[model samples]
Target: MCKEECPYDFRLAEVVSKLKEIQARKVLVQLPNGLKKYYPILRTTLEDLEIEVFLSLSHSWGVCDLALGEAKKTMCDTILHVGHHGQVALYTLSDIKIVCSPAFYKRNPIPLATRGLKLLMAKGCKRIGLFTTAQHLNYFQELREALSEAGAKVHTTQIFPWMPGQIIGCRFDTIVSNLDRKVDAYLVVGGGIFHGLGLFVTTNKPVIIADPYSNRLIEVAEEASQILKKRLFKLMEALDKKNYAVVISTKIGQFRLALAQKIRDLLRGRGKVAELVVADEISPSLLLNIPWAQAFVIVACPRIAIDHQEEYPYPLLNPGEVKYVLRGSLEEYTPKDSLVPNLSLNNVA
Candidate 1:
């Protein structure tokens, strides 16, 4: 991709200034796949500052996925991560410094917000809840003003780490629970169906996605329900499996060994064969290598099971869904906000 055509503000100057403030001689640069195209510009810019930059080839799903180990191994002074908020910066780790530089989308959201407002009004929605991802967070006030002026009651909440109207792939429960009853419909001013579906599954409200890229307003209630049905089917299928492979990711922030062990022990207590599988990257091919295990339970990221369910031939379940299997009922079947049971520094690598 061309640097001139890049739509996101990578805040390269801010990152360079921070590195200079810390007097970082060598640094590790990591970014999500979507932002990797700007690597050449990033590398050349930092090289001009006489900073030795080592690019991490590993994939980063979010701020939760950091390259701390890589930075440590390379003896770098700091790790500059792009494309996500600085939520992880709240926690202090070992010697290596972490700088989370967010990449904000430069696209105008007024047109998409106008389209969404019309759809929400057409649905007879008076009370509206607004949300978005990090990239589109800048448009929150603008969209909220547009909706409020249209005689719609708008509500939003800011949970620590996540900005107001911002939702990650796996986190939206707190924001939804706080405003679910107050709002008639939820509008996600961002790209993709993931965030919209996340809100729909967590609450009983109609979820609308204002995709600036597609220039369309989409309601994900039908699609989210379809996904829930598939998850329920997978959960039911997993109940009968005699053996299971519980997986734990080794990512700096995604590691959940305790939860994996608890799930493994839970299976063994129920007289089922359960083995712990440790991996840096979780994929169908990686799990398929172990044919003995009939089904798989990943205690890491829940999106892996929900978003990539088609890749695996067998039942792929998350830790939260495992409860329905253990209880032998579908009383509380929903995607979780946290990857592990109790999200804390202790549980992560």
Candidate 2:
């Protein structure tokens, strides 16, 4: 049973409005792995509204993973993607009208345990910038008030429609945009070390977690360090490599064919052998089949190399890390652009 403590609820009016506007029939519903639980309720609601709907069972990491094939398979003319807003990925679905509605929390400032605040206070965090996922945005004002009452000056920056002082796993431009502010520490209000560590890698600031799910406040110093250490070790392994496989994606949003070709050209110019390996989904077992490849420079989904380096047999490196491996010498090693390519945020790489 979803209790009052549950922070996420679908905005039915907005979702329904968009669906009706598009005149959608035989709609295909796509949800992130975590948001799939609400599908039954959603199915029932849409059925009552006289719209045929079916669910996509594929794994949805972010806006990057859209079930276009599943939609076509189900003969769906329209797709309703839940949980995340399609900001990062540029998917060009012409015939299918894809409507993205984020899971909004009705309650403002969900009273997660105060232990996270206490932990931050103990670590001498007076000025705190409370960051979280989109699901937790409604609770920010309440969180800010709580922090203020606890004798702390909190700084919160809004990132327009997608993230309002909150962040996703892939995008950490919030910290970059807030570099002018005098923030002592950052509090990632979401679950897991993924978002926290992403912030740490980009800003190198002190990051602590105020996880609502576990209701435990913890520091990410150990986890962040471990991730960096793993990345550094992978770079060391790839330092001597000449032959490399540039993994490319066929997925619409994640397809970096152009970037993959550019990296390949750059590698060839530098007297290195490069091959383009096309994949829809990248996994260790899939890559293990082709173990002939010396090293892999990931072009699709930066998280594959960032979070899952140990899973791969050879060195799996990011674009910037690959450059360092080619150069064999670093001007004080640090991560350039994280996931995505050299857009505006990743100009460093």
Candidate 3:
């Protein structure tokens, strides 16, 4: 029998209902790389239906990587975006049937951090800001109550229009806008170091992650610090590079063509040689052709510069980091507008 837990037992009935509602015979299914394990199950489940299923085999990190274009290219009538929320970045497409099925992983016995109570007490962190991925949102109330009972003043950023306490990798606007000044530290309530690290970088506050699977308290300071140090080193190294390629994405949400052009113009004014490289997808393997450039400034997803810099041959800094390097000061390093477009800064300096 198929388990009902998350990572399993995706209801085929809903997909059938949606397909029938829209009268869609051809469907395109897009899953984040991690959830691709469900591809076979999903395909098999849909085999008997009156739908033609096509799995999107593209590289997708977040909503920023939705396969809308691929769906259009393949002439799919409906798009099933899995693993994340229904909030695909593009805004203008109401013509096609777009179904967002978020993958869920149920945590029974409630993965509350009772054992980590001692660790939390020891950290000397009293005012805590809580954040998490959407998967663990169901247990937010229990987890918050548990933390509060442990004698810590807990706060979750809820200003986001999406799920409360939810911090997606690219957008930290929810945390930035909703957090009170009294917050001394952050507690991420899901697995993985990515969201926690992003929170730490954006807030410059100490972050701890509560992994549901392990139910252990993981301090993200050391790892986040190490990554930031590498970025700083790269920035310092690239400060002297005269030739830079400002990369822009052609995707609907990730596009920053104007920003890329602006950066290129700024570099030229500063007596540096610069060029703009436009592409739909970015990767270390994809960027290998531009060997003539000494450095590359990314106007794509902010995570590329944060996480994938080491993958590249040369320095790859985001717009804000590039500005910091060029100016050589943290005095005015406000990355209000980063790589991802239509990103709301809302006066978060």
TM-score for each prediction? 0.91, 0.87, 0.86
Q: In candidate 3, how many Å is residue 183 off?
A: 2.2
Q: Model 1, range 221-261, lDDT digits (tens) per residue?
A: 88877877787687778888988999889987678888888
Among residues 3 or more apart in sequence or in different chains, the pairs in candidate 3 whose N, CA or C atoms overlap within 3 Å are none
Clashes of each: 0, 1, 0
Model 2 score (lDDT): 0.72
Model 2 misplaced regions, further than 4 Å: 1-7, 86-93, 104-114, 158-163, 336-340, 343-349
- Which residue pairs in candidate 2 have backbone atoms (N, alpha carbon, C) closer than 3 angstroms, thus clashing? 109-139
lDDT (0 to 1) per candidate:
0.77, 0.72, 0.70
Candidate 1 CA-lDDT value: 0.77
Ranking by lDDT: 1, 2, 3
RMSD of each: 4.0, 3.7, 3.9
- Compared with the true structure, what per-residue lDDT tens digits does model 3 show for residues 173-235? 556766847687888877778778777777777777877766667788788778777777777
After the best TM-score superposition of candidate 2, give how far the Cα of residue 12 lies from its true spot, in angstroms. 2.8
Of 1 and 2, the candidate ahead on TM-score is 1
